[model samples]
Target: MPFVDLETNLPASRFSEDFLKKLASTTAAALGKPVDRMVVLVKPDLPLFIFGSSAPCVVLSVAGIGVTDTAEKNRDNSATIFPFLTKELGLSEDRIVIRFSPLEPWQVGKNGTVVTFL
Candidate 1:
């Protein structure tokens, strides 16, 4: 399975299903995998702060928003994501870093209530 998770400091409306489907297709083609076998998650948050000069590096802390996790696919999805965001959302590639995490289902809770992964 080729799983892609997108975390951005933008509006969720910026990512539509059609855009995601196309992204999935592109990702599958890049990875030489089937589209049906791919999964993607889109998360939108506030903007990011990047450091360094050339090859601008992103500053990460224990407390940060927009994090994603993938499983059993290409390791460099950021390469694909950046272009997609630029073309689709009109975002700039500079000072942007799309970090990846290995995917694992977890029992989540909010407002003192456990939520279902399903």
Candidate 2:
């Protein structure tokens, strides 16, 4: 599974499920994975404080089996994710932070069992 958990301090805007769907599709294409397996969680309007200042900031974590397997792949993923944050979320690229966690199938769980077994 390709799972993205995105948390933003910025207040919610006119975001809809359509935006998430689009993001999933973009992620799937970038990772060369099936679009139907993408899962994105967006949490906005959260009270986030950094450097004693209240500004628009986003912290996103992406975890999957093979998405972040290599440096080159990470670069490829960022190329697609960064621009979308600026254009769709209105956050400056610098204010956005993305962390990639590449998981082995056994490290993930699914339906009360390990993903690898499935």
Candidate 3:
């Protein structure tokens, strides 16, 4: 599973209901994971400041098993996501920050149990 949490100072009205689905799809495709297994949480209107200003900045965190384990893969993922974020959220490149967390299967829980995908 790939979990993407997006926290932004922008208002919720900035996003359409379908935005999450599109984002989940984009992230899953970028990571070569199943879209159904991707979870995207958008927390808008949060008090997030960048460079001492709260001018529509975003803090996006991504966690997944095997998807974010390498530097090259992370770069590739950033290459894919950066444009999407800028175009979709209308945010400048410098206004967004993304953190990737690589996780082991055992560290995740599903269906009241722990499992491995590989």
Candidate 4:
């Protein structure tokens, strides 16, 4: 399972839905998983502040199996995601913090069954 959840103080309308679609494809390529299996979520319009500043701060949590295996992988994923945020969200690169989390196979359930695909 690959999930990219974004929590931002900015307006939801400021983002492009197409970015999630593209992120699904890019994340699939990075994880060697099928694009259909990815889950992308966006929770904007939240009351968030970073470093005591309410300007525009985005906290991104990217969870997946076999995707965040190393720091190098995290850096690579950041490279892949950063440009998109700059272009779509119009935020500076330094305003975002991306965290990578491990997603175990047994944690996912689909269609009344637990599926294990790592």
Candidate 5:
């Protein structure tokens, strides 16, 4: 299954319907699956770090979010992130792994402080 985890400084509102549609189209094409068969999960992770490896590598880990409850959804979510990871960041998709952690606000904490937008 394709899996994608995105950690961006951008706000959730920025992910408009048009963007989702485009993402669905692109992801379906990449995965060789129907658009409806794909699943996508978008999370807003502010104050995050997107680091680079020694030789153009990318690793994304997202916490405190949940997407659809299906393997296809997970795969589609992962596939959707490839374009941005490759084009925007100049990193190969093969080097990246997107994982979703269905975590509660209280469960994910940094320095004993639970970070939440609510």
Candidate 6:
């Protein structure tokens, strides 16, 4: 499973109903994971600042087991995600930060148990 959390200073009006679904799909494709197992959260209209400005900015965190296990894999994932965010949000690449967390199976829980058990 892949989990994606997006926190943005932009308003909710900036997003369509399908935005999260599309993001989840893109992230799943980028990570080579199943979209059905993706969990995505989006928090918009939050107080965020970048370079001391309250402009539109996003902190996107993606986590999964083995998906971001290497620098090269992270770079490859960012290559796909960064541009998609820029185009969809109408923000500059510099205004968005994508953090990739390589998680261990034991660190994640699912179906009332640890992922390692699944």
Query: Which prediction has the highest TM-score against the true structure?
Result: 6
- How far residue 94's Cα lies from its native spot in candidate 1, in Å, is 1.2
RMSD of 4: 2.1
Alpha-carbon local distance difference test for all models: 0.53, 0.83, 0.90, 0.81, 0.53, 0.92
Candidate 4: which stretches are off by over 4 Å?
Answer: none
Whole-structure CA lDDT of model 4: 0.81
Name the runs in model 3 displaced over 4 angstroms: none
Report the C-alpha lDDT of model 4 over 31-112, residue by residue, as the tens digit. Answer: 6779898888889899988866889989988888778879998888888888777777788988888889977778777777
The candidate scoring highest on lDDT is 6
Clashes of each: 0, 0, 0, 0, 3, 0
Question: What pairs collide in candidate 1?
Answer: none
Q: How accurate is candidate 6 locally (lDDT)?
A: 0.92
Ranking by TM-score: 6, 3, 2, 4, 1, 5
**Candidate rank order under lDDT:** 6, 3, 2, 4, 5, 1
Global lDDT of model 1 = 0.53
Evaluation by TM-score, superior candidate among 1 and 3:
3
Residues 1-118 of candidate 2 have per-residue lDDT tens digits of 8998888876567458888888888778878889898888888898876545568888878888977888999999999988887888877887888899899999988899999899
Model 6: per-residue lDDT, tens digit, 1-118? 8889999989888777699889999999999998899999999999998777888899999999999889999999999999899989999998999999999999998899999999
lDDT of 3 by residue, 1-118 (tens): 8999999999999878689988998899899998999989999999889877888899989999899999999999999998899999988999999899999889988888776744
Residue 87 in candidate 2, Cα distance off native in Å: 0.8
Cα TM-score per model: 0.54, 0.88, 0.94, 0.86, 0.42, 0.95
Cα displacement (Å) at residue 24, model 1: 0.7
TM-score of 6: 0.95
